[model samples]
Target: LPPTGPVRPDSYDFSFDSYFSGIGGSGFFLGDPKLLAPASTAPTGAPFGARIASAVENAREGIADHIRSSIGGSEGEIAAALIVGVRAGIPEAINESMRRTGIYHIISISGLHMALVAGTIMFLLRGAFALFPDFSSRRPVKKYAAAIALASIAAYLVISGIVVAAERSFIMLAVMLVAVLFDRAALTMRNLAISAIAVILVSPHEVVGPSFQMSFAATAALVGAYAGFADYRAGKTTAPPVKRSFLKFLSRKLAVGVGGAAVTSLIAGSATLLFAIWHFQRVSPLSLLANLAVMPIVSLIVMPFAVLSALAMPFGFDGPFLYVMGKGLTAMIAISAWISDRSPVDAVGLISIQSVLLATIALVIA
Candidate 1:
């Protein structure tokens, strides 16, 4: 271990007990650093997981190089971050700007990314099956497609370095897949509850982490909102037969897109606001604005292009897709930066311990 360097009031005192308890670390070492000779060999044998990780890392590096060559600057870094969850190339200024604007989650490996990948796969597979009468009519192509989507999500989670939030999302996706296999509703409060329970059982410590808390909070809020308005949705579906022209249809779709974006941002932002203030002590006043501007581009263009590029790389046809992906990422970065620049500075401060406790209780109850 590196030197502790003048222990302060909050300095972590290392010990064997702490290590065993998972408090500090496993051990400490003190030695003069020396460089190894070029001819010296180290461990190179990789297990299945190691091999998978190596492949993922190599692909990320290759894609990063391609992105850099196509579109330099923070855009390449943003593309790599969005595609593979590799943010090492991202500049500190961009990171700071994202955090300030509350749009950093876009680049993080979370439910958004998982949902995009799964939804895309399921849609494409179902569409292909629809085109083939034999599969759609005689076989259970939807369930099989969902299973394949689950597998793809698993691969993505692992390659992106599975963390607590990703694990929860995967569990939810898995539960949904199982539901589809059994011909049950996929999106329900029960699925979210099961996923939360599983995540807590696997890593109870994650309950206190922002990723776990914010994710469940957002999902729960959405679930409750949908449940609350189920009757309205059911009623509306029975009387929605107003035929329109192509131009009118296009206008309606654009309106729905804007409205849906606003509502989603509102729900998610409201759910995570207190948690953000409690954990990071900062609230991005422009979070909804930033998300509204960036999410459409990310989901519709950046992520799809990146995923296609990734799939095409093995066939040496990824350059065009990556170039388009970089363009989308560039626009996204500019939007986020602009929003961040206009947002106010200074972190939101909790008034007292009582307020914090109250907020925590409210979140838990919700």
Candidate 2:
């Protein structure tokens, strides 16, 4: 999709979740989590209405478990993002940036994060298992690796709670893990396609939502593109150049943070902007720079700590880590709030959900 390229053009993943606050009328949009429970506080929990919350939580746990167990890799970074946890305030330049951006928050836990995580964990775990003799054992290390990932994924589901994009990613990854266990060949495109089918069958109404359609559309595009690119690159001439040292590579990672933040904003914010374009009433240009400026710190330092601390808490030895994570998260909140207060954030609605879906279909067809 011409409109969806900034985040990871080839993949159906772009979730710039600017906020996770229950405010901004989120319940009105997130559709259904396929589970339900009554609304009681604390230990009382949900009452007779088990149809809403309980089912959703159970579904999330099951999906998370399956996914983590399927990974022969490290998707920790992506898994950390499943919650759509962070919520930054709007920049001050355009005062209405708040209401619009808030109103525009889409499902953040989408397929791209899952793909990145699965691929990352797979590559890392495989490499680690390769180098370390301890892990290269007669035992079912691959299976265990997948299991651990699944456990982590389940924790992720409970911690993050909000389900949309992440759920789809979780489901697909789980299926692939099953395939791995069955000794079947697994390809990304095929896996993604199958996942799409499964998601639709289970939740027919998902077809009517922007999160479901957009998430898959973006992911499919990326998978197809990357596969084609990989083949193309393999056949290209002029292979080698002056090799850079580790420091150079590290620099790229750091730089990638800025680029990634901007890209996230572009992918998410731009789509929303399209709807407001006709009236010249919506625009989110500042979101990119604003996100770029802080997201690196969030991704590299803050998010990791927050995720780690949260994970550690269940073990009853998390205070220290929790403190660290809390501080980092706090810093992010403060920074985002300050920036929004200072900047001239402007935005315009660009397209309707219908148009977005049509464009996504056009993208799929192309």
Alpha carbon lDDT of each predicted model = 0.78, 0.51
Stretches of model 1 off by over 4 angstroms after superposition: 1-63, 235-240, 351-353, 363-366
lDDT string for model 1 (72-109, tens) is 78888877666666778789988888888888898787
Worst 10 residues of 1 by lDDT: 3-12
Model 2 per-residue lDDT tens digits across residues 213-271: 54565455555655776789789896576678999988987788666555555655544
Best by TM-score: 1
Clashes of 1: 0
Candidate 2 Cα lDDT to native: 0.51
Clashing pairs in 1: none
